[model samples]
Target: MPAIIYVPFGVYIVTDTVEIPVSSRVIGQAWPQIMATGSKFVDPLKPRVAVRVGLPGQVGVVKIQNMIITVKGATAGAIMMEWNIHESGQGSAGLWDTHFRVGGAAGTDLTVKDCPKLSGKVNPNCVAASLMLHLTPDSSSYFKNV
Candidate 1:
């Protein structure tokens, strides 16, 4: 049977990839933020995923709603969300009201103070992430208000 994972409003920090299995629904209340930090996601050449919807070639119902996926610290290799599940049916796998915020937040050090605009200087600490979402070649999904 499919499971419904409910994430209450809060700041969830992760240093590794968080994967969601097939045939599951993740519903977040009040747009919970999933922030990625630490050295785990620092290698730009070898990008890593923070949230993976499903494994490649997995076809099933995977729904994610009302969430905020972001990156903090020097996460230049962080791919915030990766959707790898092919929908079993039309509109079966989808994301609704899910957002990705790279920086300029409370925890993320990429604020104006750290990255001063037009400073004519590059700040490595302000490098939040390399990519926001990764929809793999074998993946197909539906997005609404995301």
Candidate 2:
């Protein structure tokens, strides 16, 4: 038989770090601010989000958090957002994760077990995803290296 990858939950993450110039730090924070809105998060039990503030004058924690967004079936998708706040004197970096797991046929969902692949490089900032859906050749795909 073929190598069947049966997963209870499927997750695809696109992590990228970002840097906001002191002149326009607000732009970098737009993503999280938008998610904070009530209409953004679909199911609280699924794609969870957590942020780490790194100020220009402050410190940044290299921590990973999943707010958890609810995935319906084998083809569910969710967007988890995080923020790293920094002081005006400097910029900050954060690891953003985007996971989606929705499988078909019998058994559990198609999760990225065994090969918990790491897509795209730790982005410079979340603004990259803010503009486009799939990455281009020059653009960063969620499954490429940094």
| Cα lDDT computed for each candidate against the true fold | 0.92, 0.25
Supply the global lDDT for candidate 1: 0.92
Superposed Cα RMSD, model 1: 0.9
- lDDT (Cα, tens digit) per residue for candidate 1, span 65-94: 999999888899999998999999999999
Prediction RMSDs, each to the true structure: 0.9, 16.8
Best by lDDT: 1
User: Residue by residue across 19-133, what tens digits does model 2's lDDT show?
Assistant: 2222222211211211221222233335323211233243332322222222222211233233333322222232234232222212222234411337555322111112112
Alpha-carbon runs more than 4 Å astray in model 1: none
Candidate 1 lDDT at 86 equals 98
Position 65, candidate 1: lDDT = 96
Span of ten consecutive residues with least summed lDDT in model 2? 123-132
